[model samples]
Target chain A: MIHLLKQQWWKYTAVIILLYVLIGGMLVPLGPSALSLYPVSIPSDTSVNFTITGYHTHFEDAKDLQVWFKPTTGTQFYKADSIVPIINSTVRIVFHMPKSNLANKHSENYDLVVNDSIDGTLTTVYAMTVAAGTGESSPAVTPANQPEVNQLKFKAFAFPFQKILFQTIRNTFFHVPMWFAMMFLLIFSLVYSILYLRTGKIEYDILASQAVATALLFGVLGLATGMMWATYTWGQPWPNDPKLNGAAIGVIIYLAYIVLRGSLSDEIQKAKISAVYNVFAIVIFTLFIFVIPRLKTVDSLHPGNGGNPAFGKYDMDNHLRMFFYPAVIGWALLGFWIMSVRVRIKLLQHKKSLL
Target chain B: MRKLLCFIIVIFTVLYTSAQSAEPIPSLMESNLKIYVVVGVLTIIFSGIIIFLLSMDRRLKKLEEGH
Candidate 1:
C-alpha cells in the first residue's frame, strides 16, 4: 500500500486528466438562449409584439425563423403571426391570442421559444402572462407545429447558458472538485486514524496527519473559489447561508485538530489522543457539511441543500458530466499525491531524528 | 520537473489548435465580457496548487541540507 503511494503512473495520470478538464471546461462556448422579453403580460384576444433579446443566437443569418409561446399547463402552442429579425441577437415577434383564451385557466404564463437552423432552439420560461379576455367565446387551442429544427446540421459542444451563472458555470470544474477531493481525503484520513487506533502503528498516524493536512488545503481552496463565484453571481462574497456557515465550522474543527497536534510533546500520547479526536472530528464535520445543510428547516442557497436540485439532476447535462466526473477523480488523485509526499517527508524526518 | 513542464506545454499546444479548429470564428467580444471571470477562477486554483508545491519543495530542500 505504501509502495503504491510512491508510484509515478497515477501522478502523471492526475496531471493529464486535470489538463483535459481545464482546457475542455474553459474553451467550450455556451449554448444559445433567449435572454429576456419586453412587456411580459398580455391580455387575451389581442395582438402583442414582443422584443426578445438572445444570447449567442444568429437571428440575422437564419433563413427559417419560427417563434411561439408554449403554455406551462397545456400542449397547445401559440405560433407567432409575424417574425422579424432586428439584429443578430434580437428579434421582434408578434403573437395573436385567440378569443376567450383563458376559459379553461384563469391565468397562464407562456414560455417563449425561438427556433432557427443555425442556433437550433432557444427558450425563455414564463416570458408572458395571458389574463382572461372580455370575449364571450371558447378558448381556441392551436395544434402543435413541431419545427424541423430537430435535424440540426451544426450543434456546438457547449455549456448550458444559465441565466445568472453565465461563464461562471466553468467554476464547476474547479470549485466543486475541491470539495469532493477534500471529502475523499478526509475519509481516507479517517480510515488511517482507525487503523492507527487498532494497530498502534506510527506509520498509520503519519498517514492520517498528512491526509488531514492535504484535506485542509483543499478545504481552504474550496472556500476561496466558492467565495469568488458567490461574489459574481449572488452579489455577496459571504451570504448568511447555512451551507456556507457549516463549511466554515468544518474547517475550524480540522484546524483545532492541527493545533492539538502541535501542542502535544510526547509522540505516542499525541498520536493516541489525536487519532481518537480524528474519529470524533470527522463525524461532526460530516454532520455539519452533509447533514445539517440538508435539513428541512435550514434554508441554504447552495444547490443540493434545503430543497434545491443538485447540479447532477438539473444544471449538468451529458456534456458537463463527461468532464465533471473525470475532474473529481483527477483532483482527488492530485490530493492523494500531495498527501503521500508529505507522509514520505514525515517518515524521513522521523528516521533522521532517531539517528 | 522539466518532464512535467514539457508535458503541460504539449497538452496546451494541442488544446489551442483543437479550440481554433472547433470554432472557426471565435467570438472574442462576448467571451471577453464574461470569460475573464473563468480566467480568474483558474488563476486562483493554479496559484494555490503552485504555492503548495513550492512550500513542499522548500521543506524538502531544508531536509536535504540537514542531511
Candidate 2:
C-alpha cells in the first residue's frame, strides 16, 4: 500500500489539484459589485439625493458600512449628509456639495466607495457626476473606517470572473489550460517522433502515437470550451476567425496523420512514414498558431489581438493570473497522466501481439 | 411537426439575434444565482467523464494482467 502510494503520488496530486481548481473556482463568492449610481447629473452647490445599487452586497450583517462619493479630479469626497440602506443591494444617500466653478470644470465625477466590516470595501469609478460643484463653503470631512474593515481582503482561493466576462470567464480555467496541456503533450510527442527517427524504435512510435491522441483529445476539449466561451462573449459558437480556423486546421492535419498511421500494416514502414508526418504536422501546427495568425490581415477577436488589451492586463486587476496559473498546471498534469496510461496500454498490446 | 419545427427555429433565431445586439444580460448574474447552477452541472458532468475514463483504464489494466 505504501509502495503504491509512492508510485502513484502524481496521479493523486493531479486529481487533488483538479478538485481544488474545480470546487474552489466555482464556489467562491465574487467581491462586492457596485452596479449603478443614480442622479449622475446634479447641480453643484445644492445637496442632492443619489442611490447606488450593488450585487452580493451583504448589507444585512455589514456591521459598520461606509459610503463615500469621491470626485475623480479632487482630493476629497463630497461627504454624504446621510447614507440610508433601502435593501441589501440598494442604498439611497444625500450629499451636500461645495459651490461649483463652471469655468474650472464642466463636470465633476465622483467615485462611490462602500466599506463594510464583513464584505470589505469597493470603489466604483465615475459613480456620480456633479454639473456645478466645486466651492470653498464645504469643509472636507475625512472618513474613519474600522480597522478590520479598513483593509481589503480576498478569499484564500477564488476565481475573479470580471465584468466583461461575467460567468463566461470560468471557461478560461478549462479552455486555456487544455490548450497549454495539449501543447505540453504534443511537444513530447514531437520529441518521441525525433527519437523514433534516430533509433528506429517501435516504443518511441507508440509513445508518439498515444501522446498525439491525448493531445488531440485536449485540443477538441479546448475547442469546445472556447466555443462555449465565444457563444457567451463573442455571441457565436463558430466565428469565421483566423485563430479558430488555424486551430481547426492544425487538428485536421493531425487527424489525417492518425488516419494515415492506421491504414499501414508494415511496422517499420509505418513508423518511418508516420514519424516524418508527425514531425511535419507539429511544425506546421506551430506555424499556424504562432506565425500566420500574427501576420493575418483580419483582426482576430481573440484576446491580445491587433494591439487591443489582452489577458494579462485584465488578469492583474482581477487576480485571474493566480487561479489561471494553477489551472494550467493541473490540466497539464491530468493530460500527461492520460497520455501515460494510453502509452502503457499500447505497450501491453504490443507485447501481446509479439507473443 | 413542420409547424412546430418552424416555430422552434423562429424562436431560436429571435433569441440569437437578440443576444447578438444586446451586449450585456447582467440579470443572469444578478438574479437567482443561475450561473452557479450551470457551472455546477458542467463540473459534475466533467467529473463523471473523468471517473468513467479512469475506470475504463483500470479495467484495461486488469485485462492486460489476467491474460
Candidate 3:
C-alpha cells in the first residue's frame, strides 16, 4: 500500500488541490468593495453632493473612512467637507470643488480614492472630472485636500469580483487552466515527436501520438471554456478578434496534423512524415499565437493584448492570485494524470497488437 | 456541498451584477445570440462521447483478456 502511494503521490496531490480550488474559489468572500460614485461628472467650484455606493463594504464598523478626489494630472486630491453614511454600502459626501487653473487648458479627470479600515483603500479612476471650462471669475473656496490614508491590513483569501467579471470571474479557475494544460500537453507532444525523429523509437511515436490526442482534447476544452466566458462576460461565445482567430487556426493546424497521421498506412512512412509535419506545425502554431496577435492593429477583447491594460495592472488582484496559481497547477497535474492513463492504455494496445 | 456553494455564487452574481446593466461591451457573437445555449448542448454531447468511450474501453479490455 505504501509503495503504491509513493509512486502515485502526484495523483493524490492533484485531486486534493483541485478540491481546494473548487471550494475556496467560490466560498471565499470578496474583500470589501467600492463600486462607483453617482453623477460622475461634477461641475467645478461647487459644494456638490456625491453619492458613493459600494459592494460588500463595511461602512458601519469602519473606524476611519476618508474620501479624496485626486486629479489625474496632479498629485494633490482636493478633499470633501464631510462624509455621511446613507447606508452601509452607500455614502453621501459633499465635495467643495475648487476652481483650478488646469481645468481651463484640459478636462482633467479625477480619481475617487476611498480609504477605510474595513475595505482597505480602493480607488476608482475617472470617477469625476473637472471639465476643462472657461476661465471663470469666482470666490476662492477652501480646497482642504485630505492626506493619503494608509490602510494596511491582513486580508483573508478571496477571489476578486469586478463589475464586468462579477460572477463570471469564477470561470478563471476552470477556463484559463485548460489553456495552460493544453500548452503543456502540446509541448510534450512536440518534444516526443522530436525525440522520435532522433532515435526512431516506436515507443516515442506512440507517446507522441497519445500526447497529441490528449492535447487536442484539452485544446477543444480550452476553446469551449473561452467561448463560454466570452458569451457571458464579453456578451459573445466567439468574438472575431485576431487572437481568437489565431487560436482557432492553431487548433485547426493540429487537427490537420492528426488527420495527416491517420491517413498514412505504412508505419515507418507515417512516423517519419508525421514527425516532420509536427515540427513544422508547432513552428506555425508558435507564430500564430505569439507573433500574429501582437501585430494586429485591431483591438482585442482579452486583456494584456491590443491596448487593454494587462492583468498585472489591476484585474488580477492579490486575492485572485492566491487561488489562481493553485488552480493552474492542479489542472496541469490533472491533465498529466489523464494523459498518463491514455498512454498506458495505448502501450497495452500496442503490445497486444504485436502478439 | 461544494457544487451547492458554487451554484449559489453564480445565482447571487447573476442577481446582483444584473443591476449594473449599463453599456453592453462590444461582441461579435451578437449575430448568433443563441450561442448562449450552445455550452449546455456541447456539455451533453461531450458527456455522451465520454460514456461511449468508457464502454468501448471496457469492451477492448475483454478482447485483451481473450488474448
User: Which parts of model 1 are misplaced by more than 4 Å?
Assistant: A38-51, A58-63, A70-76, A85-90, A95-110, A117-121, A126-155, B1-33
TM-score of 3: 0.75
Model 2, residue A328: displacement in angstroms? 2.0
Cα lDDT of model 2 by residue, A266-352, tens digit: 988888999999989998999877666666475788766544466578544455665677888888888878777777777777787
Report the C-alpha lDDT of model 3 over B1-67, residue by residue, as the tens digit.
4475577669868854663464343342222332323333345335533643565477567667865
User: What is the Å distance of residue A125 in model 3 from its true position?
Assistant: 2.6
Report i-RMS for every model: 2.8, 4.4, 5.9
Separate DockQ for every predicted complex: 0.30, 0.13, 0.09
TM-scores of the models, in the order given: 0.80, 0.70, 0.75
Q: In candidate 1, what are the lDDT values of residues B1-67, reduced to their tens digit?
A: 6677688779978977886787742243136445655676777788788878878887898899996
Q: Report the number of the highest-TM-score candidate.
A: 1
Model 2, range B1-67, lDDT digits (tens) per residue?
4475577679968976896577545444333433642354355337534654766566586766865
Q: Indicate which candidate wins on lDDT.
A: 1
lDDT of 1 by residue, A1-355 (tens): 5799989999999999999998888878888888889878887777788898887888888878888888876666678889999998999988867655555676688888788888887777888888867676555756585644445523778888887788888888999999999999999999999999999999999999989989999998998888877877787889999889989999999999999999999999999999999999999999999999998888888888887886478878888888899999999999999999999998998888889
Better of 1 and 3 by TM-score: 1
Question: Which is the winner by TM-score between candidate 2 and candidate 3?
Answer: 3
